[model samples]
Structure formats: C-alpha cells, structure tokens
Target: DTAVSQTPKYLVTQMGNDKSIKCEQNLGHDTMYWYKQDSKKFLKIMFSYNNKELIINETVPNRFSPKSPDKAHLNLHINSLELGDSAVYFCASSQASGGHYGYTFGSGTRLTVV
Candidate 1:
C-alpha cells in the first residue's frame, strides 16, 4: 500500500564509502524519476526511467547510477561518495501525461557524508 517508498531513510557515512538506495512505487505509473535537492533547496532532475529505458537530464556525476528493474522500481547506486554528494534524494513518479501532470514524491532519503 505505499504509493512510493525509499529505504535507508537517512544515511550517514564516511566520505569515500559506496551506498545504494532502493525505491519502489505501487501506483502503476509509467515513468519514474530521481531528483536531488541541494543544500540551497534547488531541486535538480538526476535520472529518469520509463519502460526500462533511461532518460537523463543534466550532467550528473558518473558515480551516480540509476537502475530500473521494472516500471515499478528504480534504485540508485553511488560509488566513492563525497561530501558534496550528501543531499536529500527523492524518488518520484508520474502518470504518462506528457509531463504536464504533477508527480508524487517519496518521503525522501537523506544522505549525510562526513
């Protein structure tokens, strides 16, 4: 019954550790996306997947990789996490309505690197 859920709601790790955050949605949406909110509260589109195909936005770090097993799930794997990588990662989904409709976001996973 959760519309969207992300595990490891809060993560605190060393500067060079690797981490993975899992996300799943049961809303039966056609598209899912990952957005990173910076310290300044600027939300940026990181990666998007639909139908097992990827549609990335701007240039995200190579260390950040998104995997979508199916339309219902998209997981993010980060390698060599840095202090700058510490941010609130949100997983969202929207019905395929040409991006006009709003998206439903998960509670969010907060990652803190020390």
Candidate 2:
C-alpha cells in the first residue's frame, strides 16, 4: 500500500473555478501538511494540521482551506482559484514528536488554472 496518496493527480480548470484535492496517509502519523510548489520549484508549507486542529501558515491565502476529517486524511479546498494557484500541491505526514525524521509525501497533485 502507498504510505501517502492523493487523488486526481492532474487537474485543469478555468480561472475562478473551485476545486478540491484529497489526501490520505497510512503511516499512522499525527501531523499532516499541505505544501505548494511554484513553477520555480520553491516549496512552501500552506497549512498544517495536528490531530484535527488547524495550524495555518500566515503566508497562505484565505482562499485555501485545509480540512482533516481524521488522523489519516487531509483535504484541501481552494475557492475562486486563480492562475497564480497553479502549482503542484503536495500532501505530507510525519510523526508529531520526531523532528529529525522527514515527512512521507504523496506524489503530488498538479493543478493548472487557465
């Protein structure tokens, strides 16, 4: 089984459309996160959730929302998607206490807004 997985690996939509991407991890981790990689390949964390509590990254836009329905799942919803929102969104999970350990990431969801 995949340690982490995301749905709809590719998404193409028009500007101003709304879309959601779903993610799940079977690593039994308590912390889950959403990251966005720009065309330049700069990766930044957009949101983090620990045991269903929200931990927003100040830099993220309000249009992006993350929901953790359970410990193993984190879903991202973007409203009024813009062309700037186009990027590869990655879902990752890691143990809450292991700072030295790296996160297990999903393949990524590529979203393109035309």
Q: Pick the candidate with the highest TM-score.
A: 2
Looking at model 1, residue 55 earns an lDDT score of: 74
What is the TM-score (0 to 1) of candidate 1?
Answer: 0.95
Candidate 2 structure quality by residue, lDDT tens digits, 72-107: 999999999999999999999989885778899999
lDDT string, candidate 1, 45-96, tens digits = 9999886689765699899999999999999999999999989999999888
TM-scores, all candidates, are 0.95, 0.95
How many angstroms is residue 10 displaced in model 1 relative to the true structure, after the best TM-score fit? 0.2
